[model samples]
Target: MSAAGVDSAPFVRLTAVTKRFGRAPPALDGIEGIVRGGRITGLVGPDGAGKTTLIRLMTGLMLPDEGTVEVLGYDTRRQPAAIQAAVGYMPQRFGLYEDLSVQENLELYADLRGLAKGERDRTFAELLQFTDLARFTTRLAGKLSGGMKQKLGLACALLRKPQLLLLDEPGVGVDPISRRDLWRMVENLTEEGIGVIWSTAYLEEAEACDHVFLLNQGRLLFSGPPREMTARVEDRVFRLSGTDGRRRHRLARLLEREGVVDGVIQGEAIRLVMKPGVTPPLGEDESVASSRTAATPPRFEDAFIDMLGGGPGGRSKLAETQRSFAVGDGKPVIEARGLTKRFGDFTAAADITFDIPRGEIFGLLGPNGAGKSTTFKMLCGLLKPSAGEGRVAGFDLRRDAPEARNRLGYMAQKFSLYGDLSVIQNLNFFAGVYGLSGITKRERIELMKEIFDFRPILDLSAKDLPLGLKQRLALACAVLHEPEVLFLDEPTSGVDPITRREFWTHINGLVEKGVTVLVTTHFMDEAEYCDRISLIYRGRSIALGSPDEMKSRIVREDLPDPTMEDAFIALIGASEAEEAA
Candidate 1:
């Protein structure tokens, strides 16, 4: 039956759909919704909120245990092929061939969609320009940076110009600038009357959608325009700033304990949502300000946090113990002297020299394809340097890579955990492989379960776990043996803001325990958490120092007090302009 008696039928419909594995509750429990045409509808929720499952169901990837799904008036179960041919679905990890060039990938997809040779050429050309990959048509997809890879994925999905597009977290791991570009593409699609159902955990991105579906544990909490949902909770928010930075976390904890604030940490400040009829203590004498005084209405993020029953900021207590090292003293954990890595005529990393102090939290900050990953791979012994020398924990990077590998734990940018294995099974496998045995391994496994609060999902398959839990489990496995130094490449990419905070807490804890950290991240705010950072551009280290020092050095005389983001833009802009000249 058509929904709400609208003359134009809904584009997509799900009625009482349920998907279950084993005896556990359904991954998607009796879900129902209607996606209208020519609008951008966001699916907003935390990990395991059934966003992916719904998308898969709609795209005919899996059969629902019960209920029915309809797309464009075609029943999904009976007419999946027809639905698949009419819709564009881009999964979280797109299926792009590394060996294929940009234009080749698009042409392949166009061919798969059964376009004729002439039509394929015309569509591919248009998509190349639309995705901004025209200049790099010959470049291998694997060689493209994270942001570029995402654009290519979108382009592949758009080859057919289907009436509907399903994007599953398409902006994950992309920088702010690249994200804006990607969104502009989506906006253009909607302008052309192509309906979209985009599932994402990033609330800021969700706010931009025409309508939003708030899901929790396989249940729909609300579905409507973002403004309507936000308006309901607008009066409850409060902006807070404190003189004691250290006390910010403590204060958030206290407010949470008092049951007054549903808050999140936004940089140095906390944005809180006050409970109904519960007044927050602003100051002893001054009048308590209304939510309006907080500057703007509460955002979708604010509403989502309130729905979760509010708590202390996403801070984890499972960090390693604290032990401070002198700022510039002691043997460097990693020392690179004129290190270089090249591929034919291209230099991936060029003449890089730096020393990362032991027990320090060091960061590599740069845009995608700035040689950060190349430098990281070289340091971790995954890739050999073409020239110069480097040491990891006093072991030569080139000559003693095996020895260096043993002393370091490295987490790649992608999800590396085995999906088919149970959480505990994965933990046990890594522990045993790392050489922990018998009672010791058992004890450590139990400790990990407790540390990550994995008891709830310990028996659940890792592949079936949500993104946030999977990330936590991955971190647990990486640190199981407690290596002396760790390398994290975009560890928090794609995680929600709360989970990102929790991940950092764990990282900070590792540093406190004298485990030197070398991490690469796209979130500029994360750079603030590092003791010192190295900014790379075009295969070279362009800037290196403490966050304050880098900021002071890069900002123009006229623009004084430039933020880290501003500093990064200015530094990269100046260097790129110089290189072009």
Candidate 2:
């Protein structure tokens, strides 16, 4: 039934909806569907798929050029103001006043939403309690952690008790624990009979929806239960284990098989997908298997990749042109000996220690306020440790910072580069900074354009490009000098599945060519690629092991076949419980 009434109609309806921005391709084109009410409906697609545009049109913030958007039986074109009042919108970048206190921001939004004063007090009390932010009401919004800020944004959007809630990519950059909390809060809203529309890049999140709308290039690809989508890949998935300690090399070779649809490193095994009606090429010589494997149930992610015609398959071009080097000459590439950082009376990172050798990928997993970033900066010479050692390539980060930094390439989480410059201009500028000159500079720029395939839009402003394209440009700039080590901070935080797989293919290739990497990410599936992981909490390393080993630690009689994410949440919970005791 519709959220607007007791009648049996969908929550929102679209009839040949179309939207265009300037002379570029249509943001949304002739889309039609019905989102069910009284539960969560997921909206998912790749970057530039018009997910944001569709959400805006439904909120009455923008009017469509053709067809109609009907929310709660009221036509958007005729009753936009009424539609706006009934809908609660939490956009990609929710407008929050960082300078104000938490309570002040809530008050401001309540006033803007026209809530009655008598009704405001009770609602404020309930919301603050529900979000667990009552104790922090007097704190400045800027001082809150990333998770807290997300909670505050949700509270502000819910001030007027909207009939329909619209959330646009709400989980970007949020760690798994915080993400779980956010999910729980949204699930509670659905139980109250409130219709929710959630747009996200995380396919794991989409898997939990009661109904899903899958879109591509502004057109509907599928609109139904997520189970139906997942069922398309039945009898197609398998996990190959017991390899010869060359997971990366073997996974790359498996991608070239004609019967294989998609393949990635899952812990010690390579999860393989065979095309429909094809027999498994099981042999004693195959690296993907030690023995014949049974078919595993497919996930929403597998189906999503199948619909996109498999990932960017084949070997990485960037890896083939590069020469291999050996850095196994008696020195570790990165070292953190009891690393610790403090801010005033509080500690950010404490007693963190790890050693990374050449040609290995190490992952850091932690909560938002946890000291992963602090430890990373100390190793890069961006910050000094309070009472510990940080070294890179045998050079002390504090004393020989320039020398250490010169040997590494860093790509920050927020796309830290010149946004106003053209794509080619940014490439040229970064190349010069890395000491490339004359023919070397010209040759490298052309090579980058060819490798990343950004030549078609080379003259476009960097800010105007889509998120995936901007990510490519950032990565190209970081590797212009071909440093021996790569430091990636949340490298694929908000990208789609296809782009993520492509990025990892390059990373694995670089590792094979003797480039060590230290990376951080929120996606658990991606974390399986790490040789070892350090799970931090409250400024300390609470757990350290390979992903498979970590999963084994959490297994019990009541539960079996636990995934990497299950281990992550369970270990954090155990640590929290122990600390409290």
Candidate 3:
């Protein structure tokens, strides 16, 4: 059914919906909106901005403390079970049994939905074919990649033929290619008269929605088309290119200026957002005037930042403590030559080769389970490679694992801090692990505390800290020993935009101080921060270049200025097609 053929009716209605949790602020306060069938509605907001709570209310999993929530014309409080049976809710991870095969998972969901015996076979066939998982039937769910898991979760949700589908951040950790594919799958179903409520932390992805509900701090900030959001920052966005090696340092200093509202690294340049009434500060210097500074179209993210009172500006305080490096030594800081990792007869990473010089940020990008992690583990000395060499700080990882490890710091995706310990205790533990002691330990810990602004939360438990602080503590711990190389694996997965900018400011700062960074991230925006990128697939490097060069590889007359995301999708799609050929 096309949008023209489908009826445009409100499937879910919120009238003065107010929900409170404990004694803190209301999770959702006085939100009134209508979700129309036959269209995709986006719920855009930062983490803990009441998106999940609002979706839960519509599912009837929880009722609002005040006001009313009506789904499919049924009152949520009085007819909770009725709403649950008619709607499909796929939370972040979904309830896929990892040990079960893909086929068995589908069958289990069919059973849970209580489909008739005659209908089970038809539904199973449709979903397997629809999600393109027919060939991987016998494969265990745990063995599937991150993108495959999301597709399986969507298939499970659709098993009951739901009238309305509620997806909570389906693209959380999936790569750009996978994210685009999953989005197309969902958009196809909306044509069949199903309503969708997609909540996401990635504001850029939400721009395609038919309608969007912008939520922030338990309030409805905006309820309209995404274009309306972009309109808020019209003519305010600008991009300026600069000489090599000066972009990051300039970004730091420019962020503190009164004329600049928010600025981030854009390849070899900075994307600057000027404060209203302030001109682009190109400077009066002849060199600065000669450089190009052009106004670009405003995006959903720019509008979002403007709505939330602008982005994180200026240089990071954390960058001020470290001395800038001269990079006199021309040797690469981190090296992986023909690295291969095998478990039994299965190879995880095969013949991977890359190198990162001092003060460079090298990124390894790949689909989930696509050898990126395997290569990282080998380079970081967590796993011994079956062949080839992994070197850091001029030491062979296999022969001198301890020595190589000592010169590097790692921050895992989950932060990996001790939940039971307080902020100060975690800092102390990390300091000791890196061989700091006596006055050295105290001084480093004190520096971390002062730079990270942890004084208020020193006595607080690690688990209780917010997402931004958790990231800060993790980064602080990683750099406590001042390692020459840093390993950041998905450092800002589900964090909001402001926190991400702040984190990158510090990272760019560290890179200037001669810290070689080997990072892996699913966020393409973050990938732009890398000085160079190696995109791997099926245990092999498929594309390697600077961000601009990568994007230019797929450019044609029809598509002149392709984005990094367009480049990623095109490259992966071309590779897959080639493999099939």
lDDT on C-alpha atoms for all candidate structures: 0.78, 0.88, 0.87
Ranking by TM-score: 2, 3, 1
Instruction: Write candidate 3's Cα lDDT for 1-581 as tens digits.
Output: 35642455579889999999899899999999998887889999888889999999999999899999999999999999999899999996588999999999988888888888899889989999999999999999999988999999999999998889999999888988788888899889887878888989889877978889999889999999899888888889998886434678777777777777788887776788887887666664333454588889888988888778777776677777876666758889998899998999988889988878899999999888889988998999999999889899999999999999899999997769998899999999999899999998998899999888899899999998877788889999999998889999999998888889888988988888888999999988788888899998888889988998898899999999788788888888899999999
Q: Estimate each model's TM-score.
A: 0.81, 0.97, 0.96
Evaluated at residue 543, the lDDT of candidate 2 is: 95
lDDT of 1 at 267: 37
TM-score of 3: 0.96
Give model 1 RMSD, 1 decimal. 5.3
**Candidate 2 at residue 546, lDDT?**
94
Candidate 2's residue-wise lDDT over 351-423, tens digit each? 9999999998999988888989888888888899999998898899888999888888889888877899999
Q: Which stretch of 10 consecutive residues in model 1 shows the poorest summed lDDT?
A: 284-293
Model 2 Cα displacement at 112 (Å)?
0.6
Between 1 and 2, whose lDDT is larger? 2
- TM-score winner between candidates 1 and 2: 2
TM-score of structure candidate 2: 0.97
Ten consecutive residues with minimal summed lDDT in candidate 2? 1-10
Off by over 4 Å in 2: 1-7, 284-286, 289-292
